[model samples]
Target: MSPSFRPRAPRPGPVKTQEELDEMVRRMKGEQKAPDNYRERSLKLHGWICAKCGREFDLANLHLLTVHHKDGNHNYNPPDGSNWENLCVYCHDDEHSRSILADYLRGDNRKK
Candidate 1:
């Protein structure tokens, strides 16, 4: 197949009815439950420091730091934080930008 001519496979998920889709949107917008406090726990487990740039954060500036999933799966939080890293906002943005650039270079435009 040509580079841009890959065949489209059927998406892998149960088909939802219209009402179910609407309800899901509503829940996501307003009534979604908390996502298991992984961020808070990861922050505590790894200290409020940027693993990328080694920047430190205190309570006053801690909001500038964010927990990043090393493997890019938010739902895969392990108690030991083996796949987590604390990165400052700038570093996190840079990391994502680099990933995007790499994907573009490799012609990987499809959503993962």
Candidate 2:
């Protein structure tokens, strides 16, 4: 190895306290970068309607609403909102109760 190639420092370990862990989870739950400006663009393109039931709504409903990916890829959140489909409060709750949501998103019931 060359003397100029120094090793990088190891990162700090995971949070020890419940509070710290919760904070980290909350931050990661939503993509905080750029304040989700792209989401607004999607809502506009889609007429801010719940794609499943054809229900119409405004952006403020976002507080109680969500955009779900049918194929389930958070990383593939539709930059143009094509991959996004609006979900109302009821539908959102129902979808998450299914195995697809539980297994992929929550990783619950996973074998240890």
Candidate 3:
């Protein structure tokens, strides 16, 4: 390398084109993965109930809800869907908060 050679500076302009935006979105979509049926069973445990408030929901409303793991481990999936539980939105929120808090206390849960 020549000592006199200098590296170029980076450009500072913002992205402005639809193609640029679409490319960015496409890159982000690559990182997402859909959950499987074992994961789907948690919604059934809620039994038309909202985890957040224990209110019974109609079929349509419950359909919009989701089953979640109390732990952050997506790999802790239960077999035969027996580990499933139904919880309305509110309860789900509380469960997540509690799980984080517990992990913090135990010192096993660190931000990855």
Candidate 1, run of 10 with poorest lDDT: 29-38
Q: CA lDDT of each candidate?
A: 0.91, 0.69, 0.67
State the lDDT of candidate 1 residue by residue for 1-112, as single tens digits: 5578779998999999999999999888887665688889889899989998999999999999998999999989999999899999999999999999999999997897
Q: Report the lDDT of model 3 for residue 55.
A: 79
The TM-score that candidate 1 achieves is: 0.67
lDDT of 2: 0.69
TM values, all candidates: 0.67, 0.49, 0.45
Model 2 C-alpha lDDT per residue in residues 1-112, reported as the tens digit of each score: 5677778987888647998888889888775665555456656677667767777776566665567776777667666677777677777777767755567677576663
Best TM-score among the predictions, by candidate number: 1
Candidate 1 regions with alpha-carbon error over 4 angstroms? 1-35
Candidate 3 similarity to native, TM-score = 0.45
Number of the top-ranking candidate, with lDDT as the measure: 1
Candidate order, lDDT descending: 1, 2, 3
Comparing 1 and 3 on lDDT, the stronger one:
1
**Which residue pairs clash within candidate 3?**
45-85, 45-86, 46-86, 50-88, 51-87, 51-88, 51-91, 52-88, 52-90, 52-91
